[model samples]
Target chain A: MKNAERKRWCLEHAGEPLTPEDEAYLKEHPEVRLEVERLALMAKLMSLKNHEEPAPHLETRCIARVQERIQSRRERGWLYRLEDALTLNSAPVWAAAAALAVLGAGLWVTLHTPPDAGVAAVQEADPGMPPVSLAAVGDVQPSVVQTSPAVDVASADREIPLNEKPILFLRMESNQLPHNSDQLIYGNGGTMPVRFDY
Target chain B: MIDPHPPDAAGQAEEVTDQELVARAQGGDLEAYNELIRRHHRKIYAMVYNMTSNKEDAEDLTQDIFYKAYSVLNKFKGDASFYTWIYRIAVNRTINYVKRRNKRAGLSLDDVDLGIERDPAFLELSARESPFRECTLTELQEKLNKALMTLSEKHRTVVVLHDIQGIPHDEIAKLLNVSSGTVRSRLFYARKALQVELSEYAP
Candidate 1:
């Protein structure tokens, strides 16, 4: 064997006797034998070094520290989970805020807009009043006035007055009055008379 | 009424397999883990002590290693033996710690144990015709530790693991995450370096 390999083998197996190949190599190269012996001695010395005794409380202290770590982790479990859930990539918080904003806007629109405005507009468009000519009032018989749906023909027939100046009878119901006055009007352009039906 | 068990109960407890204890410890059994600590703490402390040569640092590092091992016990797959896994942790932690310590200060040797003179190897060496026999045990230990500190961290680790700790090359390779050939080469060079450093003591 080569001298370097022989020395390495000797150092590696310090307690064992050299093989015939190593003995032959060492005999041929006595210079490397001293080096091998020194390494063997060093290894023996290193092995003989005493094993140091650790502190008596080392195990207890370690166990206590580990327990403390485990307990602290348990106590902060929810906070850590919450933090993980609210990370920027998750988007739960932003999604919830957006949903709340949409619901609030819907509630505001539902509260402020009147529900009966459409019905009021339809009523104003077709008020159920029939066409009546002032000149034909005298010529109109009760039967002709009865054909008008909005006139309340029976009430109109009893109130019609025949005159050369053609009086128009406009009936105002108590609920329809803007100023809480229930009155009928019968008159010409400038001079008018207010007649209270009640 | 308290029932008395045999006094050898602690001795029997020490005989439990590392795998059994590891299983129990993984299930949150504190006693099982403490038993493991009792069994292996000495060897682990010795390994770190040899690397650092400082008893206080070795004690603190040993505690830190056990605490870290317990914290990550669940991650340990049964592929390696429990002792091997713990050994890996102890070695790696000590290596990192030594690196950080090296940056701050030079290596220092603690007082040698008085019992070293009684060791069989020391007696055999003292009987030889060498300068090692001339110095006192304390002086020899200090010189050996100083020589060890002179080596690079990688070389020192290989030597400690293979030569001092008597770990097999294959096992040392696994712990170091290197091939067995690399471990052998490193061990060879490390021993060669030590032989050169301690040549005066050679016969």
Candidate 2:
């Protein structure tokens, strides 16, 4: 038979039952019969050639490796979860706190009051005569300290500054102010004594 | 027909399926998996060695095949025997290794050590054939093994599994991850190629 014809026949019957005609043909054809015998021989030889015993320690090694993998998973599971939770939620909270602190400090400086740089300069330039305490320096006479409270002014004299824009200084005698122990100087006709504690 | 026997009957038994063993190994059951490795390691090693033509590489590739099998054990289902699944892994890995080796060493499948000359089976093939008795055993065996190795990997594997290991076409299809038709085609071509290669020595 031609090579193509033989190949087609072999392929057609490879896993299936051979037709009686094809079987008889194979039995009669010396070349085809020899090849079939050779194939069967080759199969047996290949089987014998490749039957090696596997590594004796292969089983032990595989088991040990698997155990190690499981142990690692157990150890890392909680840590990974904690890391993920921290990553997902905690970063924004810290960021917001920092942002709020920055905002509050900015608002205090802008809306409520500015630092008294001007008052500090004035105090530094002044000489003698006990630089006029804002309490005594106010439009009200320092004598008003006596009429305002039971405590005398001389015993409780202290200086304080008020008004952030064009800064004012203050001094007051000991007085039982409702809000503050140190009295703050008030302008004429003002009832409240803004206490200066320091 | 030869009767099929269990590969081992004396050992302490493992109760899990191969897929279950792989799943347990994936989930951390080393002992369960070692049973799987012990069962199929030789067949995997043989398939790799035959294709690569080197013992050390075959050993390394065998190790790698099992490692790959272990890592992906969770993906295994019971659709095929563990033997077929690992056989596919062995064949694919060996083919890839051959391709890489070909690129690096500038060698082809013809260069591998096939041990055909040392084989004792030649005495049986030339038996009672009416002529050609004077040919040296080494010469005939070398010619045969060389012819076998020269076959393409696709054909070689089918021949090895079916002709050599006596695996059935359906089993081969499962191992190669192809249809029985494909296996049949490959076997036919492989056998034809071997016959052509060996035709000069025939009576």
Judging by TM-score against the true structure, name the best candidate.
1
Q: How close is candidate 2 to the true structure, as a TM-score?
A: 0.51
lDDT of 2 by residue, A1-198 (tens): 775586467444543466776677777776765556655444444443443334566445545654454455467887744553353334565687789999999987767543333333345555322333433333444454444453212212334222222223333342224545323333442233243423
Candidate 1 residue-wise lDDT at A196:
23
Candidate 1 lDDT over residue span B1-203, tens digit each: 00011121346555777778889989988788877777777678778988887777887778768867876689898787677788888989899888878543544555556677777888888888888767876677777777787788899998788767778778888888899879877877787788777777664
DockQ of each: 0.19, 0.10
> lDDT by residue for model 1 over A1-198, one digit each (tens)?
566666667656554478888877767867666656666777776776653335567656756764665455457887744543453223676788789999999999878856433323333454552333244434434553445343212224534433333323433232243422332322222212232221
Give the candidate number with the greatest lDDT.
1
Question: Chain A: TM-score in each candidate?
Answer: 0.33, 0.31
Q: How far out, in Å, is residue B6 in model 2?
A: 6.9
lDDT of each: 0.65, 0.56
For residue A130, give model 2's deviation from the true position in Å.
90
State residue A3's C-alpha deviation in candidate 2, in Å.
13
